[model samples]
Target: MAGTSTGVLMAELTTTARATRVIAAVVGVALLLAGTVWGQDDKFPFGPFSMYAGVNGPNEPAPDTRVEGTDSTGRVIVLAERNAGVRRAEIEGQEGAYVDDPSRLARIADSYQRLNPGAPPLVKVALIVREHEIHNSSATGRWWDDVRAVWDRPA
Candidate 1:
């Protein structure tokens, strides 16, 4: 009798485990299908997180970017010259969202003001992006300069 009861309990446990696995698999399938069916920005399991996927996307050569400003005396002050605690990649990431916004330039100017207490105020600020053709890792040909965003604020 004891052996029979133990056997029955083991069978029950196996069935429960199988059922749980089946339910989980069903839910997983449902989620996968749902992701494929949803319209835009919802395809996660089967979609790319990048904006574009092609040779022109991320495979293109990376350009140099700078947050430059014209001081009150019309001198160009690059962010690196001020020794601001900022990185090029940080500005690169922000360029996507702040490229068309003027406040972003203003914010950079403010940061520069904080960094240089004795320097003259900035007359205009701009986020400049320069794209150069990839001609080896050391040297490149003439590139294009594009003013992605700018703000003119008088001190």
Candidate 2:
């Protein structure tokens, strides 16, 4: 009778342990799904630079453009020009040194023209600079800057 009781108790304990493990696994999976969903959702604060679609320049004021959507890589993609518009433009960057390369700029301009046929060429392009900080275990801190371009078309 004693041996039987002990066996019964051990079985019950084993069952409980197995049940707990299963519950934990389920919870873990749920948390992982939640995290992925949250990451995919919009409304998250993106990078430092925000894109302006219509027209923004030195003398002119910024246009009232809404953020259409953000890509999976967190790049802000906006519809600067739509519906067979004349011009289109985009600016993308992360933390790094800021430089305005004419070759790259020309490519961007060409892309804009192609995307938005009949749109006026980009008259002005401005680069907004932002700073980022990185920390390392070697007790060293590094700071870098990045830039995003803002282009404007003649109205």
lDDT of each: 0.70, 0.40
lDDT (C-alpha) at residue 147 in model 2: 35
lDDT of 2 by residue, 1-155 (tens): 22474466323447889899999999877766665556322322321123332333334322222212222344344434462122322333221222444233434445555775766554443444333332332312343433354444334
Model 2 ranges off by over 4 Å = 1-102, 129-155
Which regions of candidate 1 deviate over 4 angstroms?
1-61, 135-140
**How many residue pairs clash in each candidate at the backbone level?**
0, 3
| Reference-based TM-score of each model | 0.55, 0.25
How big is the RMSD of model 1?
8.8
Which tens-of-lDDT digit does each residue in 38-153 have in candidate 1? 62333556433233333433335656798888888999978864455565656765787677677767777777788887889887988888887664453356678889888899
Model 1 lDDT at residue 61? 62
Candidate 2 minimal-lDDT segment of 10 residues? 62-71
